[model samples]
Target: MKSKFLAMLLAVSAISFSSCTKEDEEPPPPVEEPKVYQLPGLYIGTYTVTQLPNLAPLRYVLAIEPDGTITTEGLGSDGKTYYQQGTWTLTGTTVKATYKTINRTSNEVTQSATLTFNEKEGTLTEGTWKDLVNSDGYIDGKFGKFTRVKDNP
Candidate 1:
């Protein structure tokens, strides 16, 4: 009788220990997804021209829209505030702006530049601007670092 009682107690203890496991507990809560940011508004800031021989500084006010439209106004070395209307597209961290303008000589010109953005640091990676329509010359190896000043609604 004593041996039977001991065996029964051991079997019950084994069953109880085997049933209670880590898997029986509830799982952890689900993690939330990260938010995505949109870049479309007025970005007012200053840009420093980082090229050899001529290191100029310029202030710019750029308006961008989700529909790939852009308007930029800035003062050039010619002592005139130039206004340009163009279209822009953002691919990853790179932004490409294409503009069409008529010079004082009544010649229509088209230009395009690609600007890369550093989302982590909120800085612009300067890229080159080339004339697509007019093969006059190319502005090679230029850098323009810009920071946001105001965001339009």
Candidate 2:
């Protein structure tokens, strides 16, 4: 009976020492890293500018700098040389920019547009724009599109 008691005590002690709760048995799960979203580097493509009635859509190159500035130059379909200067911001997958269209010769802001880009493809996408200046052809519409042509600005 003493041997039996010793064996039972040993078994109970072994079981008690060996058993562990889930938290104590395994190292705390490795800390999970937080999720982060990265902004794109550079985008180069044509953006449409509203032209006078009967004129074709103007062709312009959109240039985004590392400092969130929009600087561009192009020949308007109406036969005017122009450039743009403005700043841009990003929210989620949307990019918003407010720029002024300046006539190269006159050096005046002829029009202004607030463009909102919402394509997440990281390659090509269409965006809508509303000209801040209420001119004849500067109405709100889906007149903006750009393709990611390069990286690192």
Candidate 3:
């Protein structure tokens, strides 16, 4: 009887100690990263820089391909003809583009813009631009408001 009690106690202790609750044994699913949703349609239109108190504004005819490649032909801040090739991506409602200018008279100019989508007018506006590549001769100021021309075709 004493041996039977000892064996039953050992078995009970083993079963109680070996088993764990599902919550403690299993971990929750890995935390997922935030999802970035791009714009629904093709982004191809005219892009213009609307503010420049010191120099002339830029007007770019932008064409964004399906593979995210971007090409533009427009006027530059230096009052010269400008052509750029770059890439763009959209995160939520904000769109960001990075491109390089082909013409470099004094220094190489790379354009990077973060723009918000205007749903009412079917346009992208209120852009924040940066010249990350050019520094020696490029002017220091905000990129100002960028407006896309209507009837983009």
lDDT of 1: 0.64
lDDT of 1 by residue, 96-137 (tens): 998765333444557676787665554555655655664444
Q: Could you say which candidate leads in lDDT? A: 1
Q: lDDT value for candidate 2?
A: 0.59
For each of the candidates, give the backbone clash count. Answer: 0, 0, 0
C-alpha lDDT (0 to 100) for residue 84 of candidate 2: 75
Tens-digit lDDT track for model 3 on 75-147? 6666777888898887767878889888776668887877786644445666566667876644334333434
Per-candidate TM-score against the hidden true structure: 0.58, 0.52, 0.54
Worst 10 residues of 3 by lDDT: 36-45
Error of 2 at 145 (Å): 3.4
- Candidate 1 Cα misplacement greater than 4 A, ranges: 1-36, 45-52, 102-105, 120-122, 134-143
Provide the lowest-lDDT 10-residue window in model 1: 134-143
